[model samples]
Target chain A: MSILDYILGSRKKTANVAKDRLKLILAHEREEGGPDYLPALQEELLTVIAKYIPVDKNNIKVSMERKGDFEVLELNILFPDQH
Target chain B: MSILDYILGSRKKTANVAKDRLKLILAHEREEGGPDYLPALQEELLTVIAKYIPVDKNNIKVSMERKGDFEVLELNILFPDQH
Candidate 1:
């Protein structure tokens, strides 16, 4: 399929493509380090933060990006204001 | 300030905190790799894709994530339908 077709056609396939691409990039990134620790870190963060506030563990997103000279690890968590 | 305060305070400061946290995490990631080449890759991708279709260069985002045993490289580009 064409790039556009692949991007707009099946959502599952599109997601897979994105995931595959990210894997390659991350492999290169990890080479500079050893192994990814984000998963463990995310779990720890959730445990610690949930102790103080109600959070949606299922929706929490933790990722990383490179900006200029800095590498940025992004964290997004959803929690109800009333909770 | 408390974590909640930092998370909910001035937008600029909140952003700074997130950036700082990400920096620390990414520092560990980059230890596996020497240098990041994503910026260069993004530019090249823009040039190649722009040749085939009109796209918003400013909105294109290239990022990476680790999932299970795979590392995901995500590419997001916005283009007008008419173009």
Candidate 2:
């Protein structure tokens, strides 16, 4: 293990891995009924949002939901408040 | 407003809300294929695990997935390492 890993503790790393795996699995599960559009949608959203604001691409999150008969797309992006 | 809320700022609260909503929506989506067994399954799993180890029920997570027609159940539980 690296010095950083040792300092942080292995349990903390395991927790992070679990969290990330959960996120990916959940994202995949939510896209099951759709046409597998998340990758393209995420790319498109990042491209458009980047034009307006300096955002963290890695932090961007997108999900789709079916509400009754309507579909809702949720986009979450993290950007710095100050330049 | 409470002093805790003021000290942390509203944006952090908003971020937490977003994260929580995403988690719930994802959990709901993953349960679409199954017969809505998560609540029961979670309870059962916690009951079983708690018999051996003192676990935080609120921190336990359960997810089911399909892999090549096989079903997989994933469980994550957080417990204090120290007694």
On TM-score, the candidate that comes out on top is 1
Q: Which lDDT value does model 1 have at A18?
A: 21
Q: What lDDT tens digits, residue by residue, belong to model 1 across residues B1-83?
A: 22222223322442332211211111011223333434444455345445544556565555555423332345554434341
Q: In angstroms, how far off is B16's CA in candidate 2?
A: 26
The alpha-carbon deviation from the true structure for residue A54 of candidate 2, after best TM-score superposition, in angstroms, is 58
What are the DockQ scores of the candidates, in order?
0.03, 0.03
- DockQ for model 2 equals 0.03
List model 2 lDDT by residue over A31-57, tens digit each.
Answer: 223234344544543454355445565
Model 1: DockQ score: 0.03
**Candidate 1 chain B minimal-lDDT segment of 10 residues:** B20-29
Worst 10 residues of 2 chain B by lDDT: B17-26
- Candidate 2 error regions (>4 Å): A1-83, B1-42
Error of 1 at A2 (Å): 41
- Report the poorest 10 consecutive residues by lDDT, candidate 2 chain A: A17-26
For every model shown, the clashing-pair count is: 15, 0
